[model samples]
Target: MTNLNASHASHRNFILTGIPGTPDKNPWLAFPLGFLYTLTLLGIGTILAVIKVEPSLHEPMYYFLSILALTDVSLSMSTLPSMLSIYWFNAPEIAFDACIMQMFFIHVFGIVESGVLVSMAFDRFVAIRNPLHYVSILNHDVIRKIGIAILTRAVCVVFPVPFLIKCLPFCHSNVLSHSYCLHQNMMRLACASTRVNSLYGLIVVIFTLGLDVLLTLLSYVLTLKTVLGIVSRGERLKTLSTCLSHMSAVLLFYVPFMGASMIHRFWEHLSPVVNMVMADIYLLLLPVLNSIVYSVKTKQI
Candidate 1:
């Protein structure tokens, strides 16, 4: 009876934590976080506007960049509210349904961003491997279709997650590890059997983000092979230069992401603060860094 009552209360209500060990530091932390988030929006917005206005920037590469920018904004926005509420106002209470929706958006936008990076890799590959046929191959229609396919795949894969989470009875403590809800965090609190949720979550990450990483690596390998065949040292160097920004963006995203994931799975002994910091870096800092690298490095941008 006690367990059932705890489950009932926890299922309907939850409290978000801001850096498990430092409540006093949350307000101070909010400043840097808020500043970086604002810069992410401003920088990405400028990039999107520039791409839209410039007729010369309407190619496949720029289009993929635009999609990525939008996804980054969305990905950041999903956590902005809960994070700010916890840091500035000390308001950590989030309803169950709202939490689930937030998690869904975060995963969707994140997966979409991964897909966009893969697309960008392919764009670079095609541009370098067959410069002449690039325009014809990645035409307007093709770009549109790629965007649709990416979104559809994300939506389809994540659609069942909410249902899976909803069925679980959260009988454990309602205090979350981070200021925002995460699928993994939520699943861990469930008192009932979570085999299905765990299995499905693993499957989703493996097939979506994992597959994206593999595809991006393959695209780069093929691109490198093609670049090596180039006889002119100057031409090869110039071609590789075009890929520098994209490579930086990928590292900015995947490094922190992989770090956070590893900490969650293998290093549970580590401080909760490590996971919180890493999550912020992955979700918040990555977009700001990506905007800076692309804007400063890409001459056309």
Candidate 2:
């Protein structure tokens, strides 16, 4: 009876304590992930190459577009390599420090991207509403200042997230459920109370992601109002078309993001695989689609 009780206790412990296994052991999962990563890299690379070769594309919009492409490439590079290795090479282990670093840069590029998108929307608004002042308002000096401000803002905002994570006392459970070390998953492993960490995460989300979306929406609203006041129906339609493309990209990115957040926070029964895939759609797929929409619709590429 004593031996049987001990065995039961061991099995219960195994069941209660989540342990990560080889993610790539499932071939069905590996192939789709591999293909998506390849597509993301290739799409961003081609955009950057075209921007470099076309001298006419050196204006503020394409300049920012080039920066956007580079950010997407960097963002994918940060997460995809490790994800691919885990799924294809059967490597499931990541050191705790490396995990923190990954989470840091992931948010870093994410914040920068958000800031860049807001800047892009503002650029479009000015171009459409005040074409005469467009060149003067968004001159080379102003673009340089905007770039500097974006980098500074991103650094200031995201610097504390990784530091906060690093200070937390992680217990023995180093295995993250998702493909990467998401902030919430890392916090869950902490033996210490994580109220502060959770609050900080929420703050970052509200200020960076929430604020960016709000500002972008506001810019489009004002742009649309101004465009409607124009006398020419054809001109108004053209402006609406451009704004619609941007709005479509924004909705594609944000809807999935909010959905994933809700599922991860409220719905525990949903599979971690589904959550990670949704995150991939929000982070990687949206940016790739943004490049495509802007390129084809605006005829800038």
Best by TM-score: 1
By summed lDDT, the worst window of 10 consecutive residues in model 1 runs over 2-11
Q: Determine which window of 10 residues in candidate 2 has minimal summed lDDT.
A: 10-19
Backbone clash pairs for candidate 2 read none
Q: Model 1 residue 202 lDDT? A: 85
lDDT of 1 by residue, 1-301 (tens): 9875654654687899988877777789779878988899999999999999999998999999999998999999999989889887888999999999999998898889999999999999999988999999999999999999999999999999999999888866888888888998998888888899889988988999999999999999999999999999999999999999999999988889889988887898999989988998988888888899999999998
TM-score of each: 0.96, 0.86
For candidate 2, the TM-score is 0.86
**In model 2, how large is the Cα lDDT of residue 93?**
69
Residue range 1-301, candidate 2, lDDT tens digits: 9875543331101001111343234545678777777777777788888888988877777777777777777777778755765666657567666777888877788778778888888988998988889878888899889888887888888788787877776544555666676778777777678898888888888988899999998998898889989999998887777666566666776788788878777885877667766777776677668767766776766
lDDT of each: 0.91, 0.73
